[model samples]
Target: MTNDFSPLSQWQLDRARRTVHRGGVIAYPTEGVWGLGCDPWNPDAVEEILELKQRPAHKGLILVAASTDQIEFLLAPLDPEMRERATRHWPGPVTCLLPDPEDRVPFLVKGDHSAIAVRVSDHPVVKALCEAAGQPLVSTSCNPAGRPPARHGWQVRRYFGQGQVHIVPGALGGNRKPSRILDIVTGQWLR
Candidate 1:
């Protein structure tokens, strides 16, 4: 699907990218709401996300990529049919739980599970951020646990406050609900 969502200026995107690379968190627009993102490979950054959201480490997190190639490591272990089924929903709001072989994903991001939740976003700003960061980002709704996700830049600031999260100004991509999560192995709908 074409991303008709509002765009962020080059400087804003650059700063957000830098923040992620430096192990800092960023708040950016997603398909349904604002999301907090950090480098998935950076354990410190993931810890910050967990602390900010008041979320437990065992709950796991979602990773958002700009393209399927960014998550090839996680997809390499799936069978052909299962891989095809999962990749077909890419560049959209569908989050698929796929097998994580070799434990490539960090324990904090995968939690206690052998599967990791992932999505290739169609949101323009998110795609840009991921491209700039050169990998998929650890993404979670931009709010404390049990609270509503932020839908606007102002709300992100309100929730995280200044200096807490670098807000990447943009608009949501018109998805009314959070992405539908499915387990590729069992064909189960998780959300």
Candidate 2:
């Protein structure tokens, strides 16, 4: 069967966005390597991601954005200093855990903590995706535990072998490394 998620020469981005609209998980480039993502607000979409990765919801997931403001819906009481630091790393790879309110942040994406991991991504397509979705998207590497994360769409398709992530072909950012995870409160390394 032909894959509807194939990367068309021009409408790839729109197709990916539509795929998300249809409650599908997707693979696209990130700051370092390719990442799998879906609408964080869509429970069905989120469930797909969890099932695809065999990830536990209690473990939580990271949300990547084009801007910090995109995460305002999930954040609460961001301190002045920490906000500044987060701003300094935004539009780039640096995931920061920020204060979150239970009412605003959903339990499916939050770990056993009061903080929510958020990233202001440096990837252009990621930024556009968030802008298109009008909110943060669940972002995670496109691989299972103990396996290397896929660096390209072909690798993603090869790993999942089809019908996995709705593939969106594009080049990854030049970083060649994953984002650094930081604790917004203690400035501690969690990753």
Query: Top model by TM-score, which number?
Result: 1
Q: After TM-score superposition, what is the CA distance of residue 85 in candidate 2 from its true location, in Å? A: 2.3
Model 2, residue 82: distance off in Å is 2.4
TM-score versus the correct structure, for each prediction: 0.95, 0.87
Q: In candidate 2, what are the lDDT values of residues 1-191, reduced to their tens digit? A: 11223224436767788888888998887767788898877888888887777788889888888786887654436667877766776767788888785546677777576887889876677777777767788898888766798887777888787787787766677776667888877988777
Provide the overall lDDT of each model, using Cα atoms, as 2-decimal numbers: 0.89, 0.76
Looking at model 1, the pairs that clash are none
Model 2 alpha-carbon drift over 4 Å, by segment: 1-10, 74-76
Q: Rate residue 157 of model 1 by lDDT.
A: 82
The prediction achieving the highest lDDT against the true structure is 1
Please provide, for model 1 over 1-191, each residue's C-alpha lDDT reduced to its tens digit, 9 standing for 90 to 100: 34566677788777888899889999888888889999988999999999999999998999999999999998888899899889988878999998987999999999989899999988888889999999999899999988899887888888888999888877788789879998999988889
